[model samples]
Target: MDTAGLEILGEEECLRLLADVPVGRIVYIDRALPAIQPVNFVVHGQSVVIRTAARSRLAIAATGTVVAFEVDEFNDNCVRHGWSVVAVGRAGQVTDDQELASVRQRGLRPWAPGTREYYLRVDIEIISGRRLRHADAPAGP
Candidate 1:
């Protein structure tokens, strides 16, 4: 992709954008191969929390495993006009009763129909993003 119209976003801006989105893709290694799953999530402090089944691949991911969580928004009529944010971190299950209760209060629900009884939290170590603005778009204030 061309880099002329791309603007690198700072960590704070990236986190703010992430907070506005409800869905993101979680990338992890599964059986020696990289896999991606779309999940509904919420940003809790510096971590991204997602709900999944206990036996699901995501829930079973070993603690401290490095993973990538990405969220983006694009214009249908103009695909190039959009922004993407990625959070790289280690995956950890929310096993603490107090933490689980706090996360539950955020009402993080899955869009899929099924029993999602496990919560996985990704402790973000690095966050980066880029925005693609049209050539004719007005500059920021």
Candidate 2:
């Protein structure tokens, strides 16, 4: 798509958008190749927290491994506008009992059926986003 009608979102706006959504995709490297997985997450300060099975791929992600987490919303109507937010960061397992308890209080539950007992946290270092709208559409409030 063209960038003519795209608006670059600020960090605060990106975080707001991230917190507004419950599901996002995490892009990581697996076996020398890029792999992306859909995960339900919650925003914890500047980090994104996700719960997965102990043996799941996300739970096995190495500490300090760079990854990208993205969330987006699109309109399928005639207007056809959408916005996407992406956060790049390092992924690590949450091992601290105190922190884990705090995250649990936030109710970051997984929608998938499984024994999701492992918690992974992505420390956001970089965040960027864009909104695409029709050329003639009115500016968003």
Candidate 3:
């Protein structure tokens, strides 16, 4: 519903916005339960690259399974200006030597301390987003 100036964002716009932000939430199963963790990510050619600690719960469980990654930008002060994007896909580790090397060059690192050497890539299977803005504000550049 486009209520109160809310609009569904197109795939292109959603992907664009996803790349603009450096952090997002990764939603996946941890011990048969739903878990979401804020993570630093980089959008690399239709995939979200994430770095986590090796053998960590998320790095182990989320791999080879369906997961959802979400990113959003909002200005609380501006009551009606914000956007959020979610990408649901299969998460996998970047084990390929060449691929891993390329991703390492992209600089996707964890914000928290410690050695988070595990690298995961979540393919963008189903992507969607919504944007809320003042009615008077125009859409698109």
- Which has the greatest lDDT? 3
In terms of lDDT, which candidate is stronger, 2 or 3? Answer: 3
Clashes of each: 0, 0, 0
Find the 10 residues in a row with the least total lDDT in model 1: 132-141
Q: Give the alpha carbon lDDT tens digit for every residue of 32-134 in model 1.
A: 8898999999999999999998888877763569999999988767775789999999999999999999999999877777999789999999999999887
How well does candidate 3 match the true structure in TM-score terms? 0.88
**lDDT for each residue of candidate 3 in 36-135, tens digit (9 for 90 to 100):** 9999888888899999988888898999999999999877566567789999999999999998999999877678899988899999999999987777
Please, what are the lDDT tens digits per residue for candidate 2 over residues 64-93? Answer: 699999999876563457899999999998
- Per-candidate Cα lDDT values, in order, are 0.87, 0.85, 0.88
Which wins on lDDT, candidate 1 or candidate 2? 1
Q: Give the TM-score of each candidate.
A: 0.90, 0.89, 0.88
Error of 1 at 76 (Å): 0.7
Which structure is stronger by lDDT: 1 or 3? 3
In candidate 1, list every pair of residues with a backbone clash: none
State the weakest 10-residue window (summed lDDT) of model 2.
132-141
Clashing pairs in 3: none
